[model samples]
Target: MSLRTRLTLLFTAIVSILLALFCGLLYGVAEQYRLREFHARLQAEATTAGHLLLGQERISLNLYKLMDRNQLTVLPDEELIIYNAQNRLVYESGTDYLALTPETLTRIRNEGKVVWREATREIVGILFTDQQRPYIIVASAVDTYGVRTVASLAQLLGIGWCVMTGLMLIAGRFFAGRMLKPISQINQRIDTITATSLSSRLPEGSQGDELTQLARRFNRMLNRLEEAFKLQRSFVSHASHELRTPLTAITGQLEVSLLAEDEPDELRATLRSVLDDVRGLNRMTNGLLELAKASMDASAVPMGPVQLDALLTQIQAKIQQLQPDYTIHLRIDPPDTHASDWQLTGSEALLRTAFFNLLDNGGKFSPDHTVWMQLIRQGTELQVTIHNTGVPIAPDQLPTIFSPFLRGRNANGHTGHGLGLALTERIIQLHQGQIRVDSSAEAGTTFTVSLPG
Candidate 1:
């Protein structure tokens, strides 16, 4: 069932149980009070009649006169009896009277008090002494007065319960609907927000409640989704452009080879060019695949403790071999004995790839300038900073420099697939590290990588 219906049912059931318990308690107390009142009145009447008989009053004549004056008649279903001092029946008052059972008589004689039973309806029997003589008086009726009082009370209580139950049900429904209205609105808004309309947001409510918080959180989620979608679109577009360029070059070279007539030298040169283009294409595709895989499954590629100084030394040696013309400087701080090996947790291959990419970018952009590589330990973190005197990047483009296939305007017409920094950033992120660029028009650019040591 819906939440509102369940809430209503729950409320109704709780109220019903409480009301039933209350009514039961009230009935019990009221029944006790009524019985006490009836007993007290019977005792008073018995005492008054006994006093008059002991004062030499005509007790039988007085009772008969009272009955006549009050127009009281002995009902066929009622009983009236009187006994004298000798325990002999002195007067009888009803047509269908049944004699008291021996057990009842014995009880009355021993108790010397009034007694009654359900079988006798409203009958009350009293024992009295007149001049040291014992007598019994019995009276019976339908108990119309008690019956009317109990019936009225029950009727009033029943009506009050009905009215209260109806009011509670109505109030319950209203409150449930009011409380759930925000959720319903949020659901509707969410339903209307498709991929095409991801920019849309739920209308904020006036109350600063949990529903409002939920809407805000949902909007933030949508914002992230929109950003991811945009990145995916850019990646696809850049991939297409990068792939088509090399394929076109290879196709052109192949066409020339097919059209040429026995010029082996020219054909060989064209085929070599084609092979170079194929190799470049292959490298770009592999880089893109690595980046995509790392983005999707970083957890699958577990990281272990990697020595930072050793890794950097290795990268510097490799860079020297690859680009002998460029000067590369390595600055490593003295290892601290207290330090835990200056090691970080990461996939060795990916970390090496990121290092190589940074070195290559430095070498490619600053062929005439010295590149500075620094490794320093600060607290529990390792910092790797690469500074190169390359062309200045615009402030606006700085934020997106590490994005996939994004090349700065000052790349100097260099041939690159632009996945280098993107892959570097991905690898750093996988290691729970951060990479940032600080650049100036005259000071060149510095890329700093911070990793947990």
Candidate 2:
């Protein structure tokens, strides 16, 4: 069932049950009142009959019977009978509607007074004491007016119950719809949003309810998606341009070599140039793959304890092999350090690549062809600083220096695909580390990395 329908039914059922209980209680009390009031009237009439017939100044049976038959004193199908202490019947109203029994007379003598019902008839028996002797008064009547009154009340209550229940059902449905109207509107608004329409935000209502908070969070998610899309587009554009350069150079050199005179010396030089371009292309492709690996979930990356000092020393040898003209200096703060102090948990290959990028960039940018590397232990953190006494990067470019394929003006002479710094940042982030750079003419440029030890 629909939510609205269920709500309506539940609302109606609760109110109906409460209303039914009230009606039942009211009907029961009304029936009791009717019985009590009618029984009191019968008892009153019976007493009056005893006073007139069994008193010292007793009147004739005919005169008393005549007075008893009057409209005011008589009831519908009423019967009155009196008996002396001897259990003999003295007077009867001549209605013959009720038969006086010996057991009933004995009960009246023993109990003093009693009231009972027979079908629609109500009977009352009382022991009447006169100066002469004790007498018994028995009266029976069918309370036709009172019965009709109570029956009319029951009919009214039943009709009222039906009418009230139906009204409640209608009211329940109307209110339930009102309560759910906002959710319906929200669903409709959500349906209209698509990937292309990510900029379109949800309208937060003034109520400040849970639904409003939900809309606000969803809008924030859309903002992030839009930013990621823009970044991806820029990345693809730069990568295509960078790839086209080397491919074009290789193609041109091959075409020229194929057309030139087949001299061994010329052919070998052209083939060597093409091979260099191919190697550069391969290096860029590997860097792109490493960048992708670094951007994945940290939990998915292989991890183990790596000693920072040993890893940096290994990278130092590799960098020297690649560029024999560059000089790197390694420094450890508080020079005597324990092995455990230099250890941190991370992917060794990724960490190696990240530090290699920083050292290479420093040496490549420095006019003196030298890079300074320092590892300092700070509490549970390991801090590494790579400094170069080269031309400083422009102040404006520092903010986006780590962006993919972004090259600084100082990078004009450097042959690189610009994925190094971006890849390094991602790898550091995967290891729960922070990397930041400071550049100036006085300090040249320095990149700082901090990782948990």
Candidate 3:
């Protein structure tokens, strides 16, 4: 059933149960009150009959006449009988009177008081003296109109209960709808959002309830999805551009070598150029593959504690072999001491590739300039900052510099596939770390990496 109908039914049931209990209690109390009132009226009539006989000094015929005159108005269902001490019937009232049984009469006479029975209806028999030699035994059936009165009151109360229960149900439905309206609206808005249109949001009402908070949370989720889509688009575009450059170069060099057939020297030179292009293509292809692997691996791979100073020293030695003209400076704060006790907790080969990429970029961009590498520890975090005295990157360009296939404006036709920083970023993120660039036109650029201890 719908929520409104269910709530209404529940309210009706609760009210009905309460009303039934209240009516039952009231019926019991009203029945008792009616019985007490009936008894009081009967006792008053019996007392009056007793007084009339005591004053007359004989079996007064006037007592029966007096009772008959008052019977219809005062006690309609009552019967009067008088018997002498000898147990003989003396005076009687009402035409249909059935005399008390011999056993009942004997009991009343011996007891010398009033007695009652409730067999077919109600019967009461009383005995009294008449100021003469004989006594009186007056037997009467008690009034029973009180039973009808109780039934009528119960019927009236039952009607009132039904009316109150209906009102309660109506009130319950109204409040239930009012309280649930926000949730209903939220559901409708959610229904509007599908795979085709994820931008739709729940309408915010004037009430600052939980529904508003829920809408805000859903909007945040949509925002994250949009960011992921943008990232994916950038990755595809950059990958295509990076791959096409090497393939085009390889194809052009091979075509030129194929066309030159007469001169051996020219042919050998052209074939060597083709060979260089092939090697460059091979290197770019391998870098792209590494970038793709880094992006795809969601699980944190196992890692051993890497000595940062030793790694840097080894990288510097390698760079020196490749480019003997450039000066490389490695500055380690508290030199020879480990900055962090925590392991890198990822693939060491990938980490080395990331660091090598950064170093290569710095060296390739600044041929004759100094490259500075610094490692420092600050409050449970380790930072590695690499500074290169190359051409400065613009503030607008710095943001996209880490994107794949993105090259600085100052690259000046230099050769690069540009997946270097992008791979670095993905690897850092996998380790729960962050990388950022700080640059100035005069001060060159610094790439800082921070990792938690």
Candidate 4:
């Protein structure tokens, strides 16, 4: 069932049940009141009959019968009888006369009053005392008018219940539909939000309801999607441009060698040029693959405790071996000589790549071809600082240093695709670490990396 329909049915059922209970309670109370009123009338008739028999001297039975036939002191469907001390019937009025029992007589003599009831009929017996004898007066009746009133009340309650239940159903369905209107709107909006329209945001209402919060979250997700789309477009464009350069160079060189096949020297030079272009393409492809691997979340990357001091020693040796003319001085500091602050959980190869990139960047740019490195323990954190006495990167370009394919304007002779720092950033983020760089002409450039131990 639709939510609105179900809500309406539930409300109708609840109202119907409550109305039934209320009507039942009213009926019971009214029935009791009607019975009490009938009892009072029967009692009054009995008292009057007793008074008449006791007050008058030798009253005639015929006169009492006349009084009843005239309907002066008797009501319809009612009977009043007087019993003598010997349990003999002395007088009676009305129809359906109740036969007095010995048990009833004994009860009247002992208690002064006796009552009996069956279905809608009620009978009351009272013992009356006189100067010469004691007698009993009994009255019995059914309240026909009260019964009719109860039937009318039941009919009215049934009608009221039906009308009220109908009204509740209508109201409940309307309210339920109104409450779900916002969700319906949101669904419609979501339907229109596809990849082509990711820039479009979800509607955020001012009421600050749950629906509003949901819309806000959807809008935020759309923003991220839009950013990813732009980045993917840029990445594909740059990658294609970088790849086409090498292929074009290789093709041009091969065409030149084919056209000038007679000279052995020209053929060798052309092949070497083509080989260099091929090597550049391979290096770019490798860098792109590494960037992709580093971009994954930390949980997706394999992790292990790497000895920071050992890794630094290895990187220092590799850099020294690569650039025999360049000097790379490495220093380590801890609170104690044997402290375990050098150990941290991360991807060792990725971490090594990040450090090697910084070291390479420093050495490549240094006019003196010297890089100074230091690892220091600060509380629960370890910091590695790499300083180069090279040309300083422009101050304005610092913010965009870690952006993909972004290079400093001051970099003139550097041949790089600009993915090193960006890859380093991704790997550091995967390791839950931070990397920052500071550079100036007078003080040179320094790269600092901080990781938790």
Best by TM-score: 1
Which residue ranges in model 1 land beyond 4 Å of their true spot?
32-151, 326-328, 331-334, 339-341, 377-380
Ranking by lDDT: 2, 4, 1, 3
The candidate 1 region of ten consecutive residues with least summed lDDT is 68-77
Candidate 4 per-residue lDDT over residues 1-453, each given as its tens digit: 876678778878887899889989998998889778878888888887777766556466778777767875456578888888988888777475466668878898899887778777788888887776798888888777888998899889889888988888888888888877888888898898888888777779899989899889888988888988988888888788888988998998788777765588777878888888888888888899999999876678889889889998999899888888778888887536664568898889999999999998888888877899999988888899999978888988999888777788756798788888989988888888899999998899999999988
The local distance difference test score of model 3 is 0.73
lDDT, candidate 1, equals 0.79
Total clashing residue pairs per candidate?
0, 0, 0, 0
- TM-score, per-candidate, Cα-based: 0.75, 0.69, 0.63, 0.73
RMSD of 3: 7.7
- In candidate 2, how many Å is residue 90 off? 14
- For each candidate, what is the lDDT? 0.79, 0.91, 0.73, 0.84
Higher-scoring candidate on lDDT, 2 or 4: 2
Candidate 2 global CA lDDT score? 0.91
Looking at candidate 1, what is the lDDT of residue 408? Answer: 89
Error of 3 at 59 (Å): 19
CA lDDT of 111 in candidate 3?
74
Q: For candidate 1, lDDT tens digit of each residue in 195-257? A: 788888887766788888888888888989989988998999989999999999899878867
User: Poorest 10 consecutive residues of model 2 by lDDT?
Assistant: 195-204
Candidate 3 structure, TM-score to reference: 0.63
lDDT of 2 at 400: 90
Q: Tell me the spans in candidate 4 whose CA falls farther than 4 Å from its real position.
A: 1-154, 297-299, 325-342, 372-389, 434-453
Per-residue lDDT, model 2, residue 369, is 86
lDDT, model 1, position 314:
90
